[model samples]
Target: MSLHDTADDAEPRGPRGIQSIEVGGQLLLALAHHGRPLPLKDLAREAGMVPAKAHPYLVSFQKVGLVAQDAGSGHYGLGPLALQMGLIGLQQYDPLRLATPLIEELAEALGLTVALAMWGNRGPTIVRVAEAATPVHVTMRHGTVMSLRDTASGRLFAALLPPERLREALGAGLDELATDAPFQQALSEIRAGQPARAEGDAVPGIHALAVPVFDSLGRLVLGLTVVGPGAAIDLGPQGAVARRMQQAAQALSQQLGWRGSA
Candidate 1:
């Protein structure tokens, strides 16, 4: 028999390595693929491992906060450290490079200013902005850090990004845009608005709409937004700008290897 062929005809085979470590990894993989926290038995069953065997690994993961356990329901979830790690990777992930062309196309096609916002060390920062041909004096630009409680892009981040990072941004004195009752009300509106969010004249006379792009991992990768003169912009659910922005966002999300919106 050729070396390419397996000794046992009943099952196809490949090279084998350490079994115990592979089994442990299955538990983690199960948790990740499930897309939600799991109890001990469910986690083990998903991994094809016994509960008793999985407990030891779970204990180790919990100690480092890679896996956090809820005291009430005894569920396990990816912890703060995991979210922090993912966010760190995002800074160097070059999502803008992948997203810019699509962004430019949308801007030119719609005659609107488009921008991509991502979580930066300080807060939600506009990393790139594509302007329309007949330019308007839009307030936002590249490297402009948005105010979480004020701007539409900022509010999007405040609504979705990890709470720990939000707290850090607030601590850095980026709270100048106060979250007063009215501001809180706007945030509520954004969350309640299904599909996407819109804020009329978020920046003085400029109107904007934003839609979040979530990755397959069920995380907010970025926000894609369009800005234009308030008089011409429409924020209605069935408006032209809002629908096009959402379509572009859907395409971009797929390009980022996202198959489903979380």
Candidate 2:
């Protein structure tokens, strides 16, 4: 038989799905990518379908609360149902559970120790670690509370938190250091999305770079850090290691429903 006939008769390799629903899903994907309301024609073009073919699908979506149109502008966007569904999914996500496997993959791929740190009651605390095949000799472990004034992960959390929260976290000491020129400059750079680094300060001959992960509401969720021997880790802002770490952090943030730029 011909290719089409053969494919029709072939055994299914995975669970079957409704072809029409799958096609409709394309429109939703397109809307999500644009991240703004779109005219019918534009949305259809983005979804690779003609407007006439897309209209019925959009109508069905609207009825189900998956899509909405602005009355005045006649532009389509995600509806209330979509927002509720997204919020529910975000609430179900566990940052540590997701970060664990990702950091493991990164550690193996980059041959550098990777860690996930969340702000604890005391400070930025290391909650998970993925040791490299040849682990460095740095004194890092789960439950290690990083120094707010010294470590890369610590500085990352310090920079990302709002001023009020920072003051609460550090109390009177932060007020004292806020006037320090170098401290202000470092936090300024980090707040602008640059990764923080520590060279032989946290641990002699050990170096680290840390990038911030944010939640859906743009809150600082955690810090993803790479650690290694001083000579092996590149802590420069635009270096290869820094780029990879930042990319990983951004990807993780997106997974957590963050739509903002890193």
Candidate 3:
């Protein structure tokens, strides 16, 4: 089998210049997603490219150790080179390092669980968590995926997302937004209107308030959330928590080089 057969069918369309490079990159991405060895024919079909055209690029990628071939089956898979590069990039980011103290402080002040979450491919995933220092408290495990429509963190994330991206993330159309009035209102409220607290959206008994943190580019990178029993942090207390979370998020954003309008 060739490499094209096992790749994603979707292909990006564009004008002439840089098309080859784009296609090659897409092919590589498809291979990476599969995470399994594939023959050149399978890869070409998946990428919707001719085998003859893809052969040279595959050879080039192999030379740089970006892709490797199995000795027995001659099938291709991602090589260690890409993993090493990704690790190098990840090392430069220290969101958890910057967020841990903030989460601890929030948890202590609010007497609730606090978490730092970032958008991931699967959804918004918690990166750091601080459990309330109480006998019983709300708990959210680190690396857990949370819903984008319901959770406080998810709302904050959607608020930071570009309009088109947000729409894609939600998988909802504009018409649906009108029918789903509550979601539209929540999106507007969280994105630019104000900080938000959500109750009984994701799961019962849990209440959460989240604020957005932006990077130097004014891009939303993560969110800070305080979570507790619904009764403990009612609407009134939730507002207070939102205010504090906003301040913390702003401070962190400044630290990250965001200078956008407040």
The 10-residue segment of model 1 with minimum total lDDT is 193-202
* Alpha-carbon runs more than 4 Å astray in model 2: 1-12
Poorest 10 consecutive residues by lDDT, candidate 2: 162-171
**How far out, in Å, is residue 36 in model 2?**
1.7
lDDT of 1 by residue, 121-209 (tens): 87878888888997768667788887666577877887766667787767745464444677666666656653344455355677777
Q: Give the best candidate by lDDT.
A: 2
Candidate number with the higher lDDT (1 or 3): 1
Using lDDT as the measure, what is the rank order of every candidate, best first?
A: 2, 1, 3
Q: How well does candidate 1 match the true structure in TM-score terms?
A: 0.58
Clashes of each: 0, 0, 18
Question: For this target, which candidate reaches the highest TM-score against the unseen true structure?
Answer: 2
Whose TM-score is higher: candidate 1's or candidate 2's? Answer: 2
Query: Where in model 3 is the C-alpha error above 4 Å?
Result: 1-93, 135-139, 163-179, 234-238
* lDDT at residue 83 of model 2 (Cα atoms): 84
Model 3 lDDT tens row, 103-209: 88888988888888888766678988888887234446877887777788887776567766655555654345546768768878776547766887877877888
lDDT of 2 by residue, 226-256 (tens): 9999888878899999998988889989999
